[model samples]
Target: MLWFKNAIVYQLNKDNLFDTQAITNAVNACPFVPCGNTDSMRSGWVSPFGESQDNPLVLDNNGQMLLRLKKEIKILPSSVIKQALAEKVTQQEQLFNRKLKKAEKLSLKDEVYIDLLPRAFSKYQFFWLWIDTVNKRVIVDSSSFKQAEDILALLRKEMGTLALTPYASDTPLEKTLTKWVKESLSFPPIILGDEIELKDAVEDSIVVKCKNQEINSQEIFVHIDSGKQISKLKLLDERGMSFILNRDYTLKRIKFDNAILDKNEDFLPEESNAKLEADFMLMISQLTDTFKSMQKIIEEIITV
Candidate 1:
């Protein structure tokens, strides 16, 4: 009827059962019986009047009665599950780090892509060119090897030849032009400590008025070291009009927003035109040279 109905049962021992009370007197002696049920009765011992079918006796391996219970118990709590998950995550992270280390070890060679636009000529005019460093070949658009070679030779004669050669498949002439300029030209380091008044003229040129004299249509070519590596050049005119030359010496294009300029007096037709050209040309020339030098160093490192 119950889950434990057929389980083995055992009894415990009474003081070997029960103890009787004793009294001593000078002339009389008395004895008393224990009150509660005796251990013998509790120990699965049947009375002489009771039948054995009502109570069955259980024995140990030695035929000795035992009184012990066995039970199924839960030892782990719910928090242990969270701890296990955290340990699993730590193991996964360790495995990922090991894999990354292995990948780093395998990557011994590095290849880099260079942007030729800013490094070659300051103004962007040539649309296409290619450089094959491995083959030592440079190709210009629609030009044969001889023509390309001759052009490069002439450029080198004027501005020294670069250590790196150009490839035929290379596109975007700016890239090759930048490389050549960086390797060949040398520019004097000039630092403009104070802001000079910038003016623009009818002609496309810029004029900067300094303390000493107004530099008008002044052509400033930037070169590094002794070689003729020209990264950028700026032509400033007396009327304050300026022409910015990129690494490739191409004229740079600029966009003017009427909405923004309309709010300021300096944006008037004449003033805006002069200021815009002068400012952009001066800034673009400096930026081109700075970037060109950095590019050359990066290319040298990558190739090495």
Candidate 2:
């Protein structure tokens, strides 16, 4: 219920200024529209609070903002187009009593695409966007980096310019994670979870994935001694958040502890808007604490 499942965080430059009122006006001017009959895809902003005209295009709770991007793509299967193109090519060959050339086949495929686009089914995707002006952070609830970038790209276009950099540490994140597994690095709030993925340094293709097993077990150490490094590690925050830390420093499969979620259960399902607001506020608070802890961890690793 408006909780972030995964976070691809970006840091906004201090020099950049984000006026929420201006953004709300600009985004509302470009509300999402479905793809036209021949259009392959379309992406635009939409009201975060469902499709109700009563809700503002951007939901600003304090300095944090919630925005939604809706993208619609026509589903024209390549196989269908190929089959139709082949049929046209064969028909043309028989009509002309000659083999159809590659250029002619290409033109026929274009015709097939135009003819099928209108009849093609449509697929829709919604991405949640969170902008924390207070912390100079922008997080997208998307597991795929490409999809996250799509949101940023649109934001940049709408805002004229957006200066953001993907969160990264000076030291390789895997080194810190590997050290944690080896017990050489321990941060009190950084609790180990049961899932880890390791990859061989010499042979990049070699990988080992373990789930529901001790991260520091003898079996895991044996693989580590043989030159495997952590590629992904699931970790728990003592403050009630759990997420997988990827080698690239992206957080995936983020889940707030039930204890944290229960804090606002008093909000009834019938009170959807109020429930969403409570959830977002709680999520933002917990996540900011988690991020600050991560900053300390990154600093510690850099020194080590």
- Which one is best on TM-score? 2
Each prediction's whole-model lDDT (CA): 0.28, 0.86
| Candidate 1: tens digits of C-alpha lDDT, residues 174-270 | 3433343334333223212211233232322444333343222132112122222223333332212233333332333211223323333455664
Q: Give the C-alpha miss distance for residue 149 in model 1, angstroms.
A: 25
lDDT, candidate 2, 1-304, per-residue tens: 4788899999988888778876787787788888888899999888777877787778899889999889999998889998988888899999999998888888898898999999999999998999998888899999999999987888777678888889987778877778778765677787788999999978989999999988879998988889999999998998989999899878899989899988888877688778778888889899888888888987877677
- Model 2 clash pairs are none
Residue 174 in model 2: shift from native, Å? 1.0
Q: CA RMSD for every model?
A: 45.9, 1.7
Q: What TM-score, computed on C-alpha atoms, does each candidate reach?
A: 0.16, 0.94
Q: After superposition, which runs of candidate 1 have C-alpha atoms over 4 Å from their true positions? A: 1-231, 237-240, 251-304
lDDT of 1: 0.28
